[model samples]
Target: MTYAPMAVMQPTAHNRAAETPLPPHAQITYMERTSSELPVTEFFRIERPSFDPATGQARFFYRLNDLSFTETLQLPMGADAAMAVSPAFAKLLGLTGLVLGVSYFKLRAPFAIEAPEIALTDAERAFVIDVYENGLGEFYARNDLARFGKLSLVAPTDPVARQPALDLPDRTLLPIGGGKDSLVSVDLLTHTGVDFTPFAVNPKGPILTSVAAIGTAPLYVTRTLDPDMIRLGKEPGYYNGHVPSTAINSMIAALCALLYGYSQIVLSNERSASEGNVVFDGRETNHQYSKSLGFELLIADTLANATGGALKYFSLLRPYSEARIASLFTQSTKFDAVFSSCNRNFRLTGNDGPLWCGECPKCHFVFLIFAPFMKKERLLAIFGKNLLDEPKNEHSFRELAGLTGQKPWECVGEILEAAACFYTLTRHADWHEDAVVRAVKADLFAQYGEEKLQLAMAECLTDSRDHHIPPALAAKVAAYAV
Candidate 1:
């Protein structure tokens, strides 16, 4: 019932208003913080968010261990932005703030982030618990913390995600990550003549060039994190690891669909996301858990409950494996020069550096997946070097090829896809002698025989039925299947 004050004027915070005047909705009284030791805080409190519909900016506040931080999301708004705001819209905005609280919550790794400031129904509260538990699965495992997980955060709850009925447009909102997977989605949707808009948050670099290559402007959203939080993470005793970034983006995309009048938010998550990296603390920790189908279903159900069924979110690429998507990516060269799957380009702190670092697991996997379907020369040209020829990359490739340790905690693909690609490459005279390939070929072949490898690859290229894609859209997509 009471609101938390904003924290933009703190000495450590950057003055965002100097760049633009504070819209009346963004204007809030500033408060100073304690100048002493970090408090032994027990709760990661989610505060009431402040928003200005005129500009579509929402500032979310959170307090962790007595330290306050503010994060902002600038949604798409203008004359085309929805003017008729309702209680449902505000509720969705509140939920956005709630999910975003995970950013600061992980710092102290609090026992509870109950978020008394945000008005969530009992069902909504349970949804937040699942997000913190499963979404932070990797975080807990990496930090050696056992506080929050399956047995940790589950409260006895009932299922009650009410779908709200509203007259939303027939168009879709495609979230392009400027990768082969998303660009593949963009090409397929265009091939089938589906009306859609490209959307991204904090888009720059390849996200810009890749969409520019497609010759369409994406609905851009800017996300600003508090400088203090970044500064604190560098200081001693701050917990840091991965958070479910896609889950955070999904919330923003839903807001875009509502404000921009789109009915569906299409994602590029693949079937491989469902596979976990390793099982620790009796939990199967997945690197792409947020992108998995289970999380997609959770968001869909939560959006229905949050908006009363006004919006829909699902992955357009869910039915296909990473190899199938990679094969489809090679079908067109429209984004070949610009599209990159390298995680090096998207790091939070450092890499605004290379198009493809050509060494990380992401680069290795992308190169591996595309080799069977793309020309060796063309694939090498795209990456500026053959990742397979680099002997230093062999160990990591072994992990991806399912010949070594558990999948290197990255958003690469299912182990079989990597093995299948390696198996397919062994027969190619042009590629068979590459250093990494030669090193893994013997081990990879013995692990999966030729017949089994071929069958697995055939299945990778073929689409599966486990998806939520509409029958009509599925038919249209099938008509243009590569």
Candidate 2:
């Protein structure tokens, strides 16, 4: 459960020295039965290494055991591609990359789960692989092997057979963030006649404002991680880096569900959560590690084993795309002016900051998707500027059109939906004059062609319905398109 600091061994001409290693830790454990009642159990042992001067990387490895399946993950220090590692890691310890690749590889039998491909350049791939290999070794050294021994006894049991359902008050805990996804989730849950309280952790003004507008009871938690640990990171030390806020937030939701007797912890993550991060070491790891299906199943299994009852953690928005969710929000009276999916606005910084810095991929994608549903004038009122007018946004639009770059890291649907929305808007007279639309016409359709582009767009639109857009909202979507 604890790790000692490894002395920095300087790499010779061949072996590079790794940075200070953090205490060994277990990321998670799960014991569950498949729908077919096949018993499955797994645990992750994370060994994080000290920073390495040679590569200028922070590394960590995770060893996973699932009774039958074993996986070893080696993650290198810097983030490759656009998904930057957390700013906390950078500010505290000079961690680079906005997102880090958390690779998972089968160590035992080759488990055949289909994952998305890693999209990275050759140099980025080399850096990612190096970090991954070094990180894996550190995880092995730091983790406690003995704790895993207890997990063997835990097995998944049928929820209905184990205990009678609790007949407590019909209370629901609606998870709310400032994003459009969660707002859509809250609306759907409210429509379902569930009496609920809105839950948030360390939320800023924009999110709080949206939640307050919902008029639900608010439950908030003030998170305080050890500042000493953070300060230690500042002193040329090592850290696992900023785990996705969603991962930490999910853990908090699990605890809250357990303590408050809530039956379900509904997440707002979409199906695109499965899209892998940019590749390192010939593997496509999850950038939003905890949001992915693998992590969701792990957390659900853990909660079930601990409580021995029906406690659920599922994405209410799982089947939908960012576009469909935005479409639903635009059609809804509750969310039209208030909902925000922009990451920059969601930061601890105040709302007075740019509501939508149209440059980021998120802004570009959001603008693209919403353009089809809302007229130009109304859309500009909401976003404050015509995002489609910017030339940088035009390139991002073409990227979504499959003209440049691979799918972005945030969500695969972001790109897919943007492409679809672009195709849809081009068919309309209103959006034809829009400069970005014109660029997509000249740049994208010329290459991909209109027929192929339309087919792809239609496919994406069809795929959006399989997700958790409630019947009322789905109806609204249909009505809007009509």
Candidate 3:
């Protein structure tokens, strides 16, 4: 279906104050509740949700063995109008549980299943193994690679079942992450006049404001983690690190699309996500694998067969590099203040803290990416400080530029792209004077050289052919390509 371009709407005026302060590190407790003996899955089921329109709660319940997880999607409006409470919608919710169940199971590193599809087919088994092994690559590398390597899947005892695709609406469901990339997608999707809903998981603070800035009321869901997991992390043998959250959110978005009748589920992942930070256990370990084209294709195929060819899922910005994405983000100046790419802002526990923790690799890289597109004053205003001006942040920037260590396992661009950004900064008179930039100037020139730096910059500006975007969606995003 073709969507026409619509003029952008004015944002609703509101007081934008900083949230109550919380310790940046204090918020997230890496909670992994693993047993020496894997937690046996008695059965997995999604109960019928209890929706209270008056109070505005859409609660989803899931039970995996003895553990129970409840996810409440706090809607902006009443749930009564979202859709009728039907079995079809209930099944979609169930499927969402099935997808999220994988992550939950990984927490304990379960070994056996008791019921409700006790085993999976070779294909089904392979899909689960891929998502788990690759998605949980970071977790495995950090915690216990020996134990994680020993993990295995239980093959299906019966044939795999596929659900017929439900008849759904033509509108698209766009997952918003309150970052520059998603904002760039918002601009493109808006310009195309696509019937799209900006949706978010655990939306608060910046995300809500960003949706408002686009003049659209967001469809948001709050995800609450099991408190027990946090307590378990404190225990001595429990493993804890990062989970492939993008994979979890993608499934949730797909469920919402099916439940609400949207035909397409859109994301903002870029080409740079495909690059691996390091290799672990003879496998390429990428922190952003779930957001990569490979995972996109895997999930797309898996969901198509599972859902009987219903919804379409793809990243709108997959073809572009992070450098190209930053370039596109500059076209829309409204999000400069509200959107934040810092991972520190959205922790799993407690209230969120500052948007930018200037000490982290994310802070250093985003600063470098924006330096080429935005002026010095504008960039400083967004980040609250000049990252390059701080000698303290030099180590982090060095990691990003490949001047010293491997790419810090953060959702940063490729090393060469970081080099390209640094090279671009050298050409910018205001940026070259920064303390960190001045320090790294010689090393960058020696490693990448002037000629190679320009080539990397050119490569970054060009789009990649690797993507799973549908033809129509490709045509829409193509207009913004640098």
lDDT of 3 by residue, 10-122 (tens): 10011111221211221222334355444354344434455555655556665656667776655444343444354344444544544555545555554442224334445
Give one digit per residue, the lDDT tens place, for model 1 in 1-482: 11121121100011111111112232222232221233444667777787787867889998876699999888766623342365656677778887887778888676756555566667677678877887887887677666544223323333444534666788888888978999989988998888778889888678888878878767989999998988887788888888898989988887777777888899999887787665545555677989988888888878877666768788888888888888888888888889888887776663676689998899889988888889888998899988889899988998886676657778988777688888889988878999988998888778778986787677777786777788898888878885
Better of 1 and 3 by lDDT: 1
Off by over 4 Å in 2: 1-170, 229-242, 348-351, 411-414, 463-482
Q: Which run of 10 residues does model 2 get worst, by summed lDDT?
A: 144-153
For candidate 2, write residues 230-339 as lDDT tens digits: 34444541233323556446545544444344666778886555543233222333445556554566555444433444556666766555555666767666655666
TM-score of 3: 0.82
State which candidate has the highest TM-score: 1
**Clashes by residue pair, model 3:** 119-156, 120-155, 120-156
Query: C-alpha displacement of 204 in model 3, angstroms?
Result: 1.6
lDDT of 3 at 413: 81
Residue 371 lDDT in candidate 3: 91
Name the lDDT of candidate 3.
0.68
lDDT-best of 1 and 2: 1
